[model samples]
Target: MFPLEHIAIRQAAYYHPEKVVHNDYYLDHFKSRGKDIARFLQVMGREQRYIAAEGENALTMGYQAARKVLSDAGLASEDLDMIVFSSQTPEYTYPTNALLLHHRLRGKSRTITLDSNANCAGMVAAVEQASRYMQSNPHVRYALVVGSDLSSVNCNPEDEITLPNFGDAAAAVILERRAERPGFIDSLYYTDSDDCENIMFPACGLSNIYNPEMTPEQIRISWKPFDGTCVVEPAAADIEEVMRRNGLTLDDIAAFCLSQFSLKNIELICEKLGADMDKFIYVGDEFGYTGTSSPFIALQRGIEQGSIKRGDYIFFWSVGAGWQLPTVLFQY
Candidate 1:
């Protein structure tokens, strides 16, 4: 067997639509129905969210994030050896969104491009895969991984469960090979699909998506409340197992960049793990639940807030629909 090189995240940047939708935007609607959303909003740690307005979709938002990352990293699009795009609400189906991004960036012919849809766990999975690819292929040096979604537009406006929490956004990360150790470490994945139908997009299914008889109401994101506590115990256990396998304690980890879906969930995970709340970086209050981009968005904010620094060990994880869990340990 050959020795593997280190691959780590280098630069990060995120993007959201210009239209800012505050909590008050939905307050009147819920009020009209004799329901107060103030407590709900506070419980979910949602103060405001960015909604994708006209002319904004997953592709453009993702492109904006990717371009910013490339520029900040002092690298050009042609310098990239691979491009992985993750989005559930992608604007294209056959022509993978990654290919579209490559074309927009005018990438070279040898660049690798593909799309992945793992629900909210998309980016975390994408980063891990891209790192492994770079480590395996010596010619592949720089890779751009992006995760973006149109959460707001997909959520049914009347459903408070989805409408109030989701925000539309995109985040891009730069991964480069380094001659060092502990750059890309181990990952643990767990799936419990008993409640697979709790949340779904295009409820009518793809086969009926283009049927002329199908109405618009049958082809949008739907949300139904499930066991929210199902995330805490397992999430904490997974992170602990990953750290345990790597001989790391809570004190050894510099920061824990968890999903931005719910502050309560992050709190619960921290409490279960006996981890300090300060070590857990959260931006869900400001960014809302950005689906695929939530974890990376939290990571970028951690970098900006000085909560995480270079050469530090950071643990990343996310919870996707169908209760998918993916945890990754990396040196940033």
Candidate 2:
């Protein structure tokens, strides 16, 4: 089989601000000076996080970044064959962020647009979706895969647990068919919905609709550290499995980009697998927890900084709501 040569990335770009509630200005108002959140964020390997300014939402961010990718590739909106969007934060859960972005892209192209609710693991799954769709219809020369999240918007202001850590951001990657070496090598996806409730925004659903009287205070938001433990171990295990099947190991990986929710989790995962934790990048400190956008942003930043290069093996591991863990291995 010929290698996939044309499967190049079109300069992934993102939009986010560098200030949020965790900063010194915001923290100074708190009785403890937001030290708890600041220290937690520091240990998580996040220095600062970005927040969506007034009027900015998931759709806007996604639309803007996707446009960047399109412009960078010198491809018109009409050239896009499909729009695959992945995000936990959407303009609305019903219309979905993907459809919203499709309209924002001017609806000029008859692209088959679909949205995935994969949270942090959504990017890997979206890549899988694009790969299968492109393989089936080589006519679809280009696909825009977007990861735009507004986690900060959902954080209950009164709920200190989630309020301090959530942030907002968006990223886009343009993928095309390549008739050469492998571009997207392999992937593994798994979920444990039983533990889904462990880490979740337990409010804002149909159930809450029936009970409007349930105020924000009544809404339970569990942001405890252990909330992520269950999925972390499985995520690491899945990464190992993917590596084993591909005849590769951690050493072969040029970089490892995950959800970037916490620096501690990144360290633990690398330690468990005996991987080089130094290769891991952290944007959560500056971008906050951008949900699905984490991995995409990481990949883009890695390439720009010369950390990720052509022909380098890169692995992705992401875990978030729904207790889901998905992994992917690729060479760029």
Candidate 3:
């Protein structure tokens, strides 16, 4: 078991772009291509989504989320010992978004900063590493874990399956080390590299190098290929294993905060696990799929909605582009 001690989420916050788009906005565009907008929304289970404005990107949204979390926690920028950020849509190919965010926050020189690119599963992966750092280092007291993505930019407007399912958002949480508390419990992570292409942007990375000669418009348009079925079985096995190793059952979990893939997928998983569907918090219908920020946003919403409470058991899980699955159970 990968149990953690003395590490707890002190505060959590999230930020969505100011611009919002409803599914109806895409109706005419899709209908011209012989695609039904109503059927698409019925399958994906999302009605509206937020899109980043012209100037807004991962860094700006992430900074806003981090600043809000720090303010809510009554902490200063200098008090942070580390900052861990996760994103697939960064502002630049170099200098790393984490380092840039550290500068934006005016974090102390001693603050360790780095980035993890796990796509939708990014936040849980960051939490695992941040919790380990806080547990091993007595000097480290507080750390900021962030997950943000501007997925709408990479979506192909003509692609019926992926175009309408994405949204832009950022979320941050402050984790503090305590003397004694029921905090993080075991976590399980799995990756199936064989299916990596199921959800990926093929043109922007090293394999397909960017062409300097191409026009600005040509360089800006790229599509992310996504297949939702790739992770279903693997995620189920991972969740079952985590529960078995922790000696807990589905009945023991007070809430389930999972990636906002779809309402259908969530229902299927709940049925497969024999867990109560009411225990899962879903924000995708209103916020759309916020990439890596999905689960954390749901966590904060659960607390605000009174579905999740202190001393409750939370089972958090996410599956990202690389077919990466990470599941964790903890007590608040």
Per-residue CA lDDT of model 1 for 43-109, tens digit only, reads 7889988888898999999999999999999999988989999998999997999999999999999
When superposed on Cα atoms, how far off is each prediction in RMSD? Answer: 1.7, 3.0, 3.0
Q: How much is the lDDT of residue 301 in candidate 2?
A: 86
The positional error of residue 128 in candidate 1, measured at the CA in angstroms, is 1.2
**TM-score, per-candidate, Cα-based:** 0.96, 0.89, 0.92
| Model 2 bad stretches (over 4 Å) | 1-10, 18-22, 25-35, 107-109, 202-204, 218-227
- Relative to the unseen true structure, what is the C-alpha lDDT of residue 92 in candidate 1, on a scale of 0 to 100? 93
In model 3, where do residues sit more than 4 Å from their true spots?
Answer: 1-5, 202-227
Expressed as tens digits, the lDDT of each residue in 205-301 for candidate 2 is 5477458687764454555445555566887888889989989877788898888877788888888888777788767777777888888788888
- In model 1, the worst 10-residue window by lDDT is 1-10
Q: Give the per-residue lDDT digits (tens) of candidate 3, residues 1-332.
A: 22435888888899998898998877777988988878768767898999999999888999999999999999999999899889878777578787888888888998988888887888988887788778888777889999999888777667776678888999998888876676778788887787665555534544444666654333333545555766667777778898898888887888899999788788878877878899989999888998888999999999999998888888888987657889887777
When sorted by TM-score, best at the front, the candidate numbers are 1, 3, 2
Against the true structure, candidate 3 reaches a TM-score of 0.92
Which of the numbered candidates is closest to the native, going by highest TM-score? 1
Estimate the overall C-alpha local distance difference test score of candidate 1: 0.88
Give each model's clash number.
0, 12, 0
